[model samples]
Target: MSGPALPPDVIEIRGIRGFGRHGVFEHERADGQEFVVDVRLELDTRPAAASDDLADTVNYGVVAEQVHQAIESDPVDLIETLAQRIADLCLADRRVTATAVTIHKPSAPITVPFDDVVLTVQRRAGEST
Candidate 1:
């Protein structure tokens, strides 16, 4: 795949919720919790804008489903890994030059009170971290 000609427009998808059994503690893996994900894709939308066709751009609906599926399917230990998995999902589209994935674990097992726990990951095409 080639790089975008333009600086790349941002397509943001937020509040993607899913139930996942992901954590280090045994109870966390067994009981599970709701995970909220925010995905931002950097891509050139000019092609789709000009052609007025769905095929010319990334279909966010499909992307959301894929992310949701990944959350429900696998049991990973770290949110970092989960974020990377989501980033990989977004970068799967050739049109997406870069992606930012923010994973929110609201019901985390923290001793102290907190509003939320979040992990954000940034990835570019053809790179893994």
Candidate 2:
């Protein structure tokens, strides 16, 4: 016999930008910077595909709003924390089985010139969700 089915559907949102005060440096916190966020949610889409009903699937628009709120809401010291928070928010929806969050800080307080600083966090349902 086959094992239990897995969540195979994926919803992705990328390059969500917002301004937030999140860092360890005094100036970093005082001078808020733009943050870019990306999120991916895994779930089962069969029901939605078959039913053709909005309620049967995860609404990406609502997910985007939630991600925006998480990014622009409170101030945290590290992007890791921010990523975790985003993951938690995504997993809050019972339809989602797993989620991955990537937070990018393009204008980080680093002397050396770099492209960007990014942190990615992934989580599954039933684990601190």
Best by TM-score: 1
- Cα deviation of 14 in candidate 1 (Å)? 0.4
Query: lDDT per residue, candidate 2, 12-119, as tens digits?
Result: 999988888889888878989999999999999999999999999999999898888887889999999889988988888899999989999999988998999988
lDDT of each: 0.93, 0.90
In candidate 2 the C-alpha lDDT for residue 7 amounts to 47
Tell me which residue pairs clash in candidate 2. Answer: none
Q: In model 2, which range of ten residues has the least summed lDDT? A: 120-129
lDDT of 1 by residue, 55-106 (tens): 9999999999999998887899999999988898899899999999999999
Root-mean-square deviation of candidate 1: 3.6
True-structure lDDT of candidate 2: 0.90
TM-score of candidate 2 relative to the true fold: 0.92
TM-scores for candidates 1 onward, in order: 0.93, 0.92
The alpha-carbon lDDT assigned to residue 90 of candidate 2 equals 89
Clashes of each: 0, 0
CA RMSD of all predictions: 3.6, 1.8
The CA lDDT at 70 in model 1 is 81
